[model samples]
Target: MSRTLNLGILAHVDAGKTSLTERLLHTAGVIDELGSVDAGNTQTDSLALERQRGITIKSAVASFVVDDVVVNLIDTPGHPDFIAEVERVLDVLDGAVLVVSAVEGVQAQTRVLMRTLRRLEIPTVVFVNKMDRRGADGQRVARDVVEKLETDAPIYFGSAITGVGVDDLVAGVTSSLPSIDPVDGPLAGTVFKVERGRAGEKVALVRLFSGTVRVRDRVKIGDSAGKVTAIAVFEGGAAPRRATARAGQIAKLWGLDVRIGDTIGVAHRDRVRHFAPPTLETVVESHDRVALHAALEQLAEQDPLINLRLDGDDIVVSLYGEVQKEVLETTLALEYGVAVTFRETRTVRVERPQGVGEAVRFIGENPYAATIGLRVEPGPAVFRLEVELGSLPRAFFTATEEAVRGTLRADRVHDCTVTMTHSGYSSPVSVAGDFRGLAPIVLREALRRAGTATCEPMHRFRLEIPADVLTAVLAALSKVGGVPLTTTATVLEGFVPAARVHELRRRLPSLTRGEGVLESEFDHYA
Candidate 1:
């Protein structure tokens, strides 16, 4: 049996990543011929709109065997609009191939992808694609990649269309890239993505890192449990039921109602997510208000980061950018048959705890009949019980946890650690409801003491324009509250409110006579 290597192929728009995926599949003899992105016949670009637009909108998975390794190639969208999809796939990749255009040199999204890959420490191979194009400059682009990426990644030159240098890429995957060995340890996995069955049942896409999942086994699904009715392993596009899915394999498991980021059997070993959550929100309007919310809930099940909720009478959905907003509208209309319009989008302002804080409320002493003490600190996002688990009735503990989750669910600010430092009860007077009611108040007071700093979402931008338009661009930046971190002769890098990005994009063309190119990504809240 061949070992498995979960690999991700990533690139910016038109970087030829989909073409490279075709070449890799064909090289492995998975397909008889190559598929073109423009022709819309590529195996991976399966969505209708994807074919119409000639770009990938969803992450596609295909399998091939290369050098005793079952290479599970996950093709991710290069467009900045669908970056949330790419971020979801990144959590499961053992390694990645970052495709760069030899002609375009290094792009803004390329820099973003590389920066994230490096930060995650996922072993990467940079493929300098479009080597056969007119302005292809492999040597210069190689230097540029080195300077911009600051990566020691093994670089290969290739034209995905012409199939040159694919052999070297193949060799690099086995030699330079990393792979994990299967283990027979305890069952451990993570639900990275979720899909719906024909009957609308939840089908979970789980990456098993160890042990085995067989039919009818009641296994842990995050904090809940579910019986595995069936299991199917990925065979390129087809998913046929299998007896069991073992370690070091990806499987589609049925009969599990799960959400993204939920762990199966054991704790997930992957690091905390590196991608920022959506910072923009829009109010959705639909003729059938009832059907609209129900459909939105179904869509949210697949990508929970979209954050579907109701604001008074209007339904609101969170999104990453304008592109995501458009995609959400299209998916709802095409898949869910829920056609809707959206109001103006706005930034999602959030409050973050400024420092370590502790607050306690005791029965009789406070307005509540429960005693709960909590400590909040600026750290990794986690909820821990510093107090013994058995101290309170299981229901009271559960209620306390629910209170914490609800309070933090809408917080888009930086992560903070919550710890239950103390807990007590006056016997019958301390009902589960008492703790649940007091937990939030105590936590809020702790947050207040820690200092509530409201922050608006900000985008880190890089602007390149001609020197002649420097004054005009600088003046334009000032109007939008752009603060340049570094200003060069023609390049300006800075942070601006996300709401100003669209306005800046519109002004760039006239400001630089259509020569100015601006690239920005959500950096942080301030």
Candidate 2:
């Protein structure tokens, strides 16, 4: 039996997460000497931009042995812009190490990370980093953990730079993480990361949760299946050929065309979920238009949650915050050698039909020479097309259905995908040679007439402040279009427009004289 743990290290920006990773690998003898994030030579912050900025932009993977256990570590970026990166990692994580700064204490991102970890029910251990800093206080940080994060888990103090308290932290991880019980079932795993090799062959990093997989095993992903040309176990950011990987192991595989969040083995049982949608979007432009599109297309393959798409002639990229925007800009210039400009940013919005509606495109009027009728109604899921098995000519069925689903998935009115639970179509006349081309037009018209209610992304926020500043905070919230649902002497809870969230966050500290605490999460699109 192989003893492996898929552990993820998470922290706020500048919290010394990558430093801790370096220290861990060094202590385990995986690396001889420590590399500094400041020097851009750290083992995990592999990209040039990450090294130059001294901040991790993408999640990195490495392997080290700890007390006879093989730990595959994933170091996640601390900036909120790359949160989607963190969310994807959570899908494959067996346990997580939450690195909190001893000097800064529990910051906003720390609170958000804790909420997500608890919500996902992933067992966690808190590591208080930077104990040697000028203002570092382990006890104070621990207290902040309890008061701000509301977690009672065991805490370990460590400095990623000086290597103090690292041994104890590793020991705590070895003792605290729950061992995964291998199930006797067919092979199952989730593809958490995708990359393009130098030869342009697709590579993926997968976390197998059950059964066993081998180098030549045939794997199924969605409707696509391919033989595994190669398999390698990750070691200190490198992969060495491994004949087989069993349950609870993370492996890098080749010769597979799969995207992030895709499942392997029994699809229903192993499908990965839970990704926060992007809240903002910006139009990307470059001097060489074709190069810009090509670059974005490749990047979209790496991180699908970015939802890179073309709106009219503008290529729009979804983003989390300003930090993400900066990283994307830097990556294009540094990695792809294409300097690009982004238009003014806007909050992404979605919409749902207010009521049922229908539209018809007459056979003679339309260029396709086909009469297509569609009934659009509201529902929870994205699209469900109910067409009589033989309603259309045999050849046009697949194309027609694809058109319907494709149109439904496009940005209709609010730049959000229009979801329809039930849409039915029946055309009695037999149409030949792709007459279904007009179906999308009819569906798009129907959706427009159906009426839509715009929904802006909203954040549910909790604020703790001095009782004396209650009135001032209330006024600030109102000025920012915040609606409080509940309020007490020191605590406030309410929904605020995500676009205005940054404004409120900036004002809270000054309003409370750096004593106010604010924690927020995406509640819904309201």
TM-score of each: 0.86, 0.92
Which candidate leads the pack in TM-score? 2
| Poorest 10 consecutive residues by lDDT, candidate 2 | 415-424
Per-residue alpha-carbon lDDT of model 2 for 1-526, expressed as tens digits? 4477889999999999999999999998889989998788999888888888899888889998765577899999998888888988998888999999999989989988998899888999999999999999999899999987999878999799999999999998988987565566888898889987788888898888888888888988877898898888775446788898778878888988888888887663544545467888999988898988888888887888678877789899888888788888988887688999999899988777777777776656667656666666666544444555555455565566677766655563332233222222335454543345776787778877887788899998999899999999999999998999999999999999999998998888889999998877777887
Candidates in order have lDDT scores of: 0.86, 0.81
Model 2 sits at a Cα RMSD from the real structure of 3.0
Q: Give the top-scoring candidate (lDDT).
A: 1
Q: Please list the residue runs of candidate 2 whose C-alpha ends up more than 4 Å from where it truly belongs after superposition.
A: 181-184, 268-275, 385-387, 393-398, 412-436
Q: What is residue 143's positional error in candidate 1, in angstroms? A: 2.1
